[model samples]
Target: MTTRVATETFPMPDGSLGARLTMTAGRANSLEPGLLGDLASALDEAEAQDTSAILICGGRNFSSGGDVRAFHRASLDGEAVAYANAVVPRLQAIVGRLIAMPRLVVVAARGAVTGGSAGLLFAADLAVLAPDAFVQPYYAKVGFAPDGGWTALLPERIGAGRTLEWLQSDRRLDASALCDAGLATAVSDTPEMTAARLAAEGEIGTRLATKALVWDEARRARINARLEAETAAFLERIVQPDTALGMSRFIERIGS
Candidate 1:
């Protein structure tokens, strides 16, 4: 498989190390099977270098979530369950690692960010949202349950009742609305530039300490449990006839 993520390092003005992870493969920067390994490799490099901050960005959109086309194809091949089992665990592990990272991590989001990609935004210590950025709770629309720590992270950011309502309604939230709801750190026309600047300028030691304090052992344990449950639910749902129908409708809608 081709590598979807690109990592690079740059020296900060203050002599701190900076790293970037860019998602390069797939039209919508869709998360695929090897993405976790790619991200882990970047994280490993950052950690080894004692990087002060890491910025994650994507081409066009931050991410459109999982590869629905891939899922549909797998469904037809009677391999959807196998695909899910392979990818979902890796996603869980990566999210866990992000939360546990000892340095600052930020997301620079633009265009459509949905499903598992939206869940990834939650793992970031901060997120910079472009003016054109939007978030979609895409699982229900695709007949899959939430994954990538969505169950554990979103409620805390937006409140449980509101999160539940949003998931069921499948509402799309724009950058302004997300920032208003406290889910996004800032809204800017130049989100990537802003995120990169922040990553370079922010107080690294304080940010690392804050991250460590916020995502403690108990929180990590809870997130792990939720991820496991989400994977189980998703595997069950993906193979269902209704899920296939939903996915088909989604594809047709997009095609039309």
Candidate 2:
């Protein structure tokens, strides 16, 4: 197993809290199980501090989603089902927490954000992407259905029809397309700095109030249900012959 680094939290100058994901090695910050636990703990610490806003920043690629190579290895070891069942639920829980957070949430991402990592864009109240950043829905390519709230939250941003089309196309969405589709608040050369400035300048009370008005318990419940269904379906599909073949090919490509 790869060594896991905890999420680091820093006090921002503007009275907000900043959280940086420290797990950037291997497959562009892939979502390892330990990283997920660190993320959840970091969020809890941020809330405990009563920070006015929360800023999440990542490495060069923000995240490349779950580690496909790890999945392939697990499959070869005959542990794919157990791996998916353990990881997907934790991913869903983290996504749920992000959606239900009381304070403002902001994300600054660069490089390729795909798979489960792309779901973070939708859960965030505001997201800033670097000019070179791209979002890719990689589930279809891997022969797994979307999970981590992608199916539920993406449609709210880009509409059901467009989201379905985009998912099926298996294409990467550039910064401009993400901004135009309402998934990104802005596309900037310095996305992390821009996100910090925006969080500092915005009125905390108003932003929190607006979020409260827009997001309610019932909607959250629906999202949770959808996440559960997606996770279950993905676990079932990933063990099939086609998905196994697809995963093996992906591992080969990455290895080469």
Candidate 3:
């Protein structure tokens, strides 16, 4: 409904189908609920009409995570429960949609992905992180446990021990390290060249059809399972001291 959730479908310079999330706010293109729903609809449309794989990219800095300004405003009124009930479910739905998208979903990560954005990258089928790109999941850094299916999806990609380390460390993961940790498919020194090549391969009908049949259903189910599993973990963690401390430290660190 809101034009803020813009979807532009155009042929890539190399002839692939590309989907650009068109709202730019600061270095982080933080998505609102409307934008997330619009993205899901756009993907569904593209899935029905275009057999070409979809490329998800952003305006400037990919995505910097949850709109902390929005979150903070909600928290300011001492209505923490209201904020959690409203925001977290929408975030989870977005994660589910990203995971269930029935095409070869590729992410072109140019800069930083934090919060829910990082979770989306983890669920993507193929992700190419630019050499300078970084990733941070800020849930633990805040006063909450992981949401957006992060608990389930992160462990699958980076393993439980390492996932715990990454979350607990409150550090940023550069593109190369992400690739090495198995979180990303590749790290692209030349993002343009890599994106171009992927576009070429993506435009092929055979690839899309093959992916739709082989990977879509299976991956979606896996992601759904992960979401449920992670939600439980998150609910439990939210009541723990460690999670509260982690969140407090993250909030203070970010503010100062």
Candidate 4:
């Protein structure tokens, strides 16, 4: 009821239920102020319903990250700071929630996952990427400091040294590379089905218990603290003239 699409409940391995949330709004599933909060609320709904696993299927594309075109417009209007203020905190909350979510969190990544991108994609218990899917970081090119857990959750998933080097370079992490880096759990033509099948393999209660132990309050606190740090740096950079210029050029380069 909270999302653009209906929540489809599925069968989990232990005969409990699972929920599937499909995102479909804006081009390439671009992030919107309302949509982000709605999705987060949808997760709340699923959790309230006691769903053991939740599958997020991003329609067409996983996401083009935050709406750069919108950001570009905000820059032109000198309201980029306000726009970012509106967007980032909500996004950060969802990413943090996923980090310590008791029920399994899964993302079905289909097209491009770019920009500071969806930290939730990386934050998920499992990300099943479509074979042709790719994730790229455009923060350097856009002159934006990484938000959405680029520096936070990612280093936790990959590694600190590698994350730094990777961020500095211009590269696309294709599904294969994503798997090899341990960012994605698997790559398949049908990512939703893949996620569903994976979700059906374990005893939900026991798995959730282990999740609680591993993603403990201490770990959750660390992740939240790091996310807050990213938010601070991001707000500082997004208001700068250089980042406004970068946003302009990047949007023109992409012809959007």
Model 1 C-alpha lDDT per residue in residues 8-47, reported as the tens digit of each score: 8877767887888898866587778777668777788889
TM-score, structure 1 vs. true: 0.94
Between candidates 3 and 4, the lDDT winner: 4
Single out the weakest 10-residue window by summed lDDT for candidate 1. 198-207
* TM-score order of candidates, top first: 4, 1, 2, 3
Collision count for each candidate, in order: 0, 0, 2, 0
lDDT of 3 by residue, 1-256 (tens): 3454455665654454666444444436775655565666766667766535566776557787666555555555554445555556666776776655555667777887877678778767677878889987766556566777667677766678988887788788899888887767777865534654675554456655765665467766886776766655655555556654565566677673
Q: How close is candidate 2 to the true structure, as a TM-score?
A: 0.92
lDDT of 4 by residue, 1-256 (tens): 3455457798775777899988777777676787787788788889998898999888778888888788878877888889988888888888888877788888888888886555868788888999889988888889778888988888877789888887899488899998999888998999999989998887777777987887789878887898999988888998888988888888789894
Tell me the deviation in Å of residue 95 in model 3: 2.6
Q: Name the runs in model 1 displaced over 4 angstroms.
A: none
Clashes of 2: 0
lDDT of all predictions, in order shown?
Answer: 0.83, 0.80, 0.65, 0.83
If ranked by lDDT, best first, what sequence of candidates would result? 1, 4, 2, 3
Model number with the top TM-score: 4
Q: List the residue pairs that clash in candidate 3.
A: 142-247, 143-247
Question: Could you tell me which 10 consecutive residues in candidate 3 have the lowest summed lDDT?
Answer: 18-27
